[model samples]
Target: MLSICKIYFMLFLYLSINLFIMALYFILLNMEVFIEYNLLSFNSLSMVMIVFIDWMTLFFMSFVLFIAALVTKYSEDYMGLDKSLNRFILLVVLFVLSMMFLIMSPNLISILLGWDGLGLVSYILVIYYQNIKSYNAGMLTALSNRVGDAALLIAIALMMNFESWNFIFYLDFFKNDDMMKIIMFFVILAAMTKSAQIPFSSWLPAAMAAPTPVSSLVHSSTLVTAGVYLLIRFSSAFSPMFMDFLLFISLFTMFMAGLGANFEFDLKKIIALSTLSQLGLMISILSLGNSDLAFFHLLTHALFKALLFMCAGMIIHSLNNCQDIRFMGGLSLYMPITCTLFNICNLSLCGLPFLSGFYSKDLVVEIMSMGYLNLFVYLIFYLSVGLTVCYSFRVVYYTFTGDSNILVLSTLNENSKIMLSSMIGLVFLVVFMGSILSWVMFPFPYFICLSFVMKMMTCFFILMGIFLGYECAKFSLEYSIKAVLFYNFSMFSASMWNMPFLSTFGVNYYPLFLGKIYMKNFDQGWLEYYGGKNLYNSLKMSSSSFQLFSRNHIKIYLLFIILWLMFMVSFLII
Candidate 1:
C-alpha cells in the first residue's frame, strides 16, 4: 500500500500534467469556459458558484499543482519520521485544492472562499512545529492576511451595486466609475496584504517558521502570488494614478526585501525575503500595465523558488535543523548535488543569463526602461535589481564557497534519494521553463530602442552586485567589528525597517494603552461610580427613607386628627 505522502504525490503530479495539457489546448484554441451554478436568487441578486476557465487560470493551476507534487514528494523524506505525516500530507492537499479554487474563480465570493482557505491553512502550516516562535509567526501571518480578507470582503460588498458578483465581466466596463474605483482600491489593498508589500511585509519572513515544504509552496505560487494574480485579473481596471501609486509601493517593497535579505543570516528567511522581493517585481511590472510580463515572471519564479526551498530543506535536514548561514560553509565539498542545485537556483534568482528568471526579469527591466516614468522611479528600479543580485551572491558565498563553519564531527551528504529526485525533477524547468514560456506567451518580440549605456545598465548592476556580495561575505579580523560601528542602521535594515515591530507591538501598543485607560477611568472609575455602584447606593438610600416614612405615617396621621379636632372645638367656642 502506498503511504499517504506517496498517494498525494502521485495524485498531484497526475493533476498537474493534465492541467498543463489543458492549458496548452486552451491557449492554442483561444478558448475560455465559464460554468455557473445558481445557488439562490433574491430580488435581482444571485448567489452563484462560478468557475471561469481560461488559459491563464489553467496555466497557473498547472504550475501550482506541479510545485505541490514535488513539495509533497520532497516532504515524504524530509518529514518521514514525524508521526503525523499523514495529517501534514492532508493539509498540503487541502492547500492545493484551495489554490485551484482561487485560480479558477472570477467571482469575488468564490475567490474569497479560496483566499480565506489559503490564509487559514497557511496559519495552521506555519504553527506546525508547535513552538512559541511558530505560534507567534502563525499569528502574525494570519492577522496580516486578515486585513486582505477584510478588503476583499468590502470589495465583494461594493460589487453588489452591479447585481453580479463576477468581477471579470465588470472590470473593463466600469473602469471610470467612482464606485468601481473604490472597489478596485479595496482590491489593491487586498493584494498588497496578501503579497506582503510594505506595511504588510512583516509576515513573509516570519512565516518561515513553517515546515520547509509548506514554505516552499506558500512563498512560491500560492499564498503570496494570489495577490499578484488578483491584480493581473483587475489590471485593466486601474487608472493611471492608481497604477503609479502601486508602482511606487511595489518598487519600495522590492528594494526593502532585497536590502533585508543581504543582512539576513537565517537560510529560510533569506529565501522568504527573496520571494517577497520577486512578488514586488511582479506587482511593479503589473502596475506598469504589463500583466502578461508579471504573470510570466510569476510562473517562472514559482518553478525555481520551490526548488530553492527544497534545497534549503535538504541542507537544514542534514545539518540537524541549523538554518543560520553564518554557521554553514563549504557545503559544496560534502553535498555536491544539493549545493550545485542550490547555486543554480540562486543564480537563476539573480536573473543570470539563460536561466528561468532571466527571461522574465530582464524583460521587465527592459520594459520599465521604455516607460515614460520619472528619474527617481528608474533609479530605484535599477537599484532594486542590483540588490537582488547582491543578496543572491551573498547567500552563495556564505553557504557554498566560504570555509566550513559547521562542526568537525557533523555528517553532511545528499543521500536522500526521494528528496533529491523531487529537486531534480524541478531543475530541468528552472533551466528551460523561462525560454519556453517566453516563446509561448509572446509570439512577437517587443521593440527595443535604447542607447547602449542604458541597455548595458542591468549588466553593470549585476557585476557591481557580485563584487559587493563577495566583499560582504569575506571575513577579516580588522573589519570583523565594523558592523558594530553602524549597529543601529544594520538593525534597522535587518529587522525589515522595523516593520514587524510596527505591525505588531507598534500597532497594538497605543490601542491597548487606550483600552487600559478606558478600563481604569470609565469601566472601573467614573462609570463604576455613576453607573452600577452609584445606582445601587441611590436605590438603597431611597428604600431606607421610604421605610422610615412608612413606619411614622400612622403616628403622623393620629397627630393630624387630634389637631383638627382641637381646631374645630376652638372655632365652635369662638
Candidate 2:
C-alpha cells in the first residue's frame, strides 16, 4: 500500500505529464484558452476571475508540478523522521497549488491571491524548525515578500482605469500610455522583490534557514521564478527607460551574487546565492528585450537547480544537518551517486557544453555579444559569468575534492533509495531539458556572428575562473595569512556586501529610532501632557474645588453676609 507522501507524489507526477502534453498541443496548434467568470459588474466595469492558458503557462506549470512531485518524493526520506511530516507535506502541496494559480492568472487580483499565498506558505516553511534563526529568517522572508504584495495591490488598483483586470489583453494596447507605464513599473517592482533582485536579494540567502526540501522547492521553480514569469507575461509593456533601469540593477545583482558566493562558506547559502545570480541573469536578459531567452533559461535553471538542492539535501541529511562546505570534503569518495549528481548540476550551472545550462546560458551570452550594449555591460556580464564558474568550482573543490574534514566515524553514503530515486529522476531532465526546451521554444535558429576574440571571451574567462577557484581553495600558511590580511573585504563579500544587514538592520534602525523618539516626545510625553493626562488633571482639580464649595456652602454664605453687615454699620456710624 502507498503512503500519503507516495500518493501525493504520484498524483503530482500524473498531473505534470498531462500538463506537458497539453502544453505541447497548445504550442503546436498556436492556441490559447481563456476561461473567465464574471463575479460582479457595475457601470461598464466588470470584476472577473480569469485563467489564461497558453503554451508558456502550461509549460511552466508542468515543470513546476514535475519538480514538486520529485521534491515530495524526496522529502519522504529526507524528512521521514520528523514528527510533523504530514504538515510539511501539506504545506508543500499548498505551495505548488499557489504556484499553479500564479502561473494561470492574468488578472492582478487573482495573482495577488497566489502571490500572498506563496509568501505566507513560504514563511511557515522557513520557520518549520521552530528556532530563533528560522524565526528571524521567516520574518525577513515574509516582510520582503510583503513589499511585492503591496506593489501588486497598487498595480491592481491602477489597472482600474482600463475597466478590466485582465492585464494580458491590455499590455500591448496600452504599452505606450503613461498609466500603463506606471502599472508596469509597479509590476516590475513586484517582480524585483519576488525574484530577490538587488536590494531585495538578502532574503533569498537568509531563507536557507528553512528545511532543505522546502529550500529546493522555494528556490528552484516556485517562489523566486514567479517574478520572472510575470515579467515574461507582461514583457510587451516595458518601456526603454524601465528596461535600461532593470538592466543595470539586474547586472549588478548578477555580479554581486556570484562574487558573494565565492566568499560564502555555508553550502546551502552558496547555492542560494547562485540561484540569485541566475535570477539576475534572467531579468537582465529580459530587460534586453529577450523575454523568451529569459523564460528558456528559467526553465533550464529550474531543472538543474532542483536536482542540485536535492543532492545537497542528501549530503546535509547524511552529515546530520551540517551545511558548511569547509567541513564537507571527500564526499565523492563515500557518496558517489550524490556527489556525481551534485558536480553535474554544478557543471551545468557553469554552462558547460552539451549540458542543460549550456543550451540556454551559452546562447544568452552569445546573443548578448550581438547586442548594442555598452562596454560596461559587456565587461560586467562576462565577469559575472566568470565569477559563476569560480564559485561553482570553489564549491566543488571545497565540498568534494579537498581532504576529508568530516569525522572518521561519520558514516556517509547514498543509502536512502527514496531520495536517490527522486534525484535520479531530475538528473535526466537536468541533462536533457535544455536542449528539448530550446528546440521547442525556438522553431527558428538564432543568427549569430562574432569576431574570434569575442567568441572566445566566454571560454577564456571560464578557464581563468577555474584557475582562480583552484588557487582560492588551496590551503597554505601564506594563503591563510593573506586571507587574514584581507579579512574586512572577505567579510563584506561573504555577507553579500552587507546586504543582510542593510535589508534588516540598516532599513529598520532609523525608523525604529524615530519611533522611539516619537514615543518619548509625543505619545508618552507631550501628548500625555497636553491631551489625556493634562485634561484629567484639570478635571480633577475643578472637581475638588467644587466639592469643597459644595461641602462648605452654608458657612461660606454666613461669613459673606456678616462681612457685608459690618461694612454697612461702619458706613452709618461715619
Candidate 3:
C-alpha cells in the first residue's frame, strides 16, 4: 500500500515537472532563456525576486523533480523487492537533490557539495542489495571517486587561496600558468576518475551489481555527465597539457572500451563498456571546444543512452533472476515490446541516420575532421564508432534473435507498469528524438536527415556482429571461457594499473614479463614471489605507530587536527 501511494505521488511529481518544464521548454529549449543573473542583497527584495534563477537552475530543478517522480515510480515497484529499498530511495532522492544543486551552482563550493552527495548516494545505491559483491563494488566506487574528488579539492583550495569562489573570479585565480596548470591537473584527474576513463573505468562495469533503476540514473544521465560538464565549464582554462590529457584519455578510453564491449558477455557489462566508450566520444568532441556540437551530443546521448539503459534494465530485470546474459538468451518473443525498444535504442545509439544520435554526434565528427588530430588517431576513433555499432547490435542480437527465434527464455517478465511506462516513453524518444532535435539543431530536416559514410561502416559492423554472434553461438562455451579470461585479465590488470608500465617496458625493453620499475609497487609482480606486498604491509602496519607518536606530540597533533578542520571549514565557508 505504501509502495502504491509512493508511486502515485511520484507520478504526480513527474507530471508536475513535465508540465512546469514543458511550459518553459517552448520558451527555453528554443529561445535564449538561459539568463545569466546578477544578485544583490536579499534584504530589500520581494520573496520571489530574492530567489535567483536561470536556465541552469531550471534544468536542475526539473531534473530533481522528475527523478523524484522516477524514484517514486521505481520505489512503488521495487519496495519489498530489494531488501534495502528504503535506504536506496533515500539515497536516490538525495542524489537527485545533489545534482540539482550542482547544475545551478555558479561557484565551485556548491558543486563540490553536490559532487560529494552524488558519490555517497551512488555508494549507498550500489550496495543496496548488500552482498560481498555489492560491498566490494561500492568500496571501489568510493575509493576511485576520491581520486577525482581529491583533484577537484586541491584545485579549489588553490583557487580560493588567490580569488573568491565566484565563477567570475576564476579568471583572476587562473592568471598564473603554474597555478592554472596545477588546477587543470587536479580537475583533469578528478574528471578522469569521475568519467571512468581507462585504467579507472573497471568500476563502472562492476557497478552493475547495483539495481536497474540506480544504474539507469547513474549510467545514463546524472553521475557520468558531471565530467563532461566540468570540461565544458572550464573550456577557457584548459592548457596544452589539459588538451593532451583529454585527447589521449578520450581516444584511449574509446578504443579500450570499444574493444572491451566487443568481447564482453555480461549483459550489463557490455552496456557499461558502451557507456564508457560513448562518453569517450563526447570527451573527444569536447576536446575540440565545439560547445554546440558537444552540448547537442550531450542532449542526444542523454536520451538514447538513457533509453538504451532503461531497455537494458528491462532485459536484465526480466531475464536476470540475479543472473546476467550468461544465463539469458532468446528473450525476443516473450518480451516483444522490450526487444523492439532495445533495437531502436541501439540504432539511435549507433548514430543511425535520421535517428537521434546522427545530428549531434556527426556534428562532432565534422568538427574533429577540421581539427589537429592525426589521421591514425581519427581512424582509431572511426573504428571505435564501428565497434559501437557492433556491440549495440550484439546486445540486441543476443537478447532478441537466435537460431531458434521462438525459444522460451526461462525468465519471467515481472516489470511493473510504471517501469514499462518509463521504458515505453524512452522508446518514443528513441523513434522520434531525431525529429525533436531537428527543430533545435540543423542535423536533420523534415525532408532529409544526416548520414555520412560512417553510417555505412556502422551498418557493416553491426551486420557482421549479428552473424558473428550467430556463428559463435555454437562455440559459446569456449568463447565464454576465453571471454572470462580476457575480461577478468583486463579488469585485474586495471586494478593493478601495471599494464601501462608493461606496455612501456615492452616498447623499450624485453617484450615478455616487461613490467616497469615503478609498477613493481602496484602488482604483486615481484611482490607475491618475494614479500613485496607483505613487506609494504608490515611497514604500513607499524607506520601507524610512527605516525601516532608524531601525532601524539601535543603541538603536532593539535595543529594537524585544527588544520584538517580548518581545511573543511574553509571549503564550506567558501
TM-score of every model?
A: 0.90, 0.90, 0.74
Query: Which 10-residue window in model 3 sums to the lowest lDDT?
Result: 46-55
lDDT of 3 by residue, 288-334 (tens): 66644565676667667766666666665665443355455567767
- The lDDT of each candidate is 0.91, 0.91, 0.67
* Clashing residue pairs for model 3: 148-190
Residues 1-574 of candidate 2 have per-residue lDDT tens digits of 8887999999999999999999899999999999988889999877777899999999999999999999999999988999999999999999999999999998888999999999999999999999999998999999999999989999899899998788878788888999999999999999999999989998999899999989999888999999999989888989999999999999999999998988888899999999999999999999999999999999999999998899999999888788988888888888999999998998899999999999999999999999998999999999999999998998888888857888878868888999999999999999888889889999899999999999999899999889888777674213655677566676788888998788777997898899999999998998989999999999999999999999999999999999999999999999
Candidate 1 weakest ten by summed lDDT: 472-481
Give the true-structure RMSD of model 1.
Answer: 5.4
lDDT tens per residue, model 1, 259-322: 8888778999999999999999999999999999999999999999999999999999998899
Question: What TM-score number comes out for model 1?
Answer: 0.90
Query: Best to worst by TM-score, what's the order?
Result: 2, 1, 3
Residue 216 in model 1: shift from native, Å?
0.4
Off by over 4 Å in 3: 1-68, 78-80, 172-176, 320-322, 403-411, 441-574
